[model samples]
Target: MKTLPALGDDARVRLSRQGGFAAIHALSRPREIEFAQCDISQRTRICSVLEGCLTLDSTVSGRGDQRFYQIEVNYRSGGQEDRMVLKVPEDQAPGELVHLWDTGQLL
Candidate 1:
């Protein structure tokens, strides 16, 4: 995996899940952009949690009966594009990050 740059407020995080159903929730800091599943207020919180590559230290495995999560982070800085993406099984993902797929809540 590539190292993530020091992210700025413009950073964006998308949480996607799959198992019996599919869903996506995005936290985007750029105020003007509009996306249905986006909850702007959570942008700062999620971004802070994502710093230092949280939850990316090791590879995660999944089972068919449980939900799996894909976390994608994106941002542009200094004329370059930088991003980090990871997939984690429900059993291994952080509780707060997984909550969004089920209850649309974050801690």
Candidate 2:
């Protein structure tokens, strides 16, 4: 596994997509996205969508074939660490964020 770059007073968003009729596991590999490295608009969209979820640790129910996405966020400020995790149904995930998962480029 490759290590994500260190963040100093910055944030990171890691997205994991899994769960499908043809899938084997409940969760697929997670891709780490450096928040500061993303395009301004992408970062803004992600931040806005997740703004209500910065402190939430929950999951949304969905059908068997529906994909599940696990979003892991880590933030560091003032030498303190803040973390949040959210597993939501495919329809509930933001398109911009999902695009980042499908492709490393945040467009």
Query: Which consecutive 10 residues in model 1 have the weakest lDDT in total?
Result: 27-36
lDDT per residue for candidate 1 within 7-102, as digits (tens), equals 555666666665533333332111221122446566545654455335443454334455566667777778677777766665666666655555
Q: After superposition, how far is residue 8 of candidate 2 from its true place, in Å?
A: 7.2
lDDT of 2 by residue, 1-107 (tens): 22223443279877888677777653576787776677677666666656643333235434568787777779885688877667667766667656767775556
For candidate 2, give the lDDT: 0.65
Cα lDDT listed for each candidate: 0.54, 0.65
In candidate 1, the residue pairs with backbone N, CA or C atoms under 3 Å apart (3 or more residues apart, or in different chains) clash, namely: none
After superposition, which runs of candidate 2 have C-alpha atoms over 4 Å from their true positions? 1-9, 21-29, 39-42, 52-58, 62-66
For model 2, the run of ten residues with the poorest summed lDDT:
1-10
Mark the regions of model 1 whose C-alpha exceeds 4 Å error after superposition: 1-4, 19-44, 51-53, 56-66
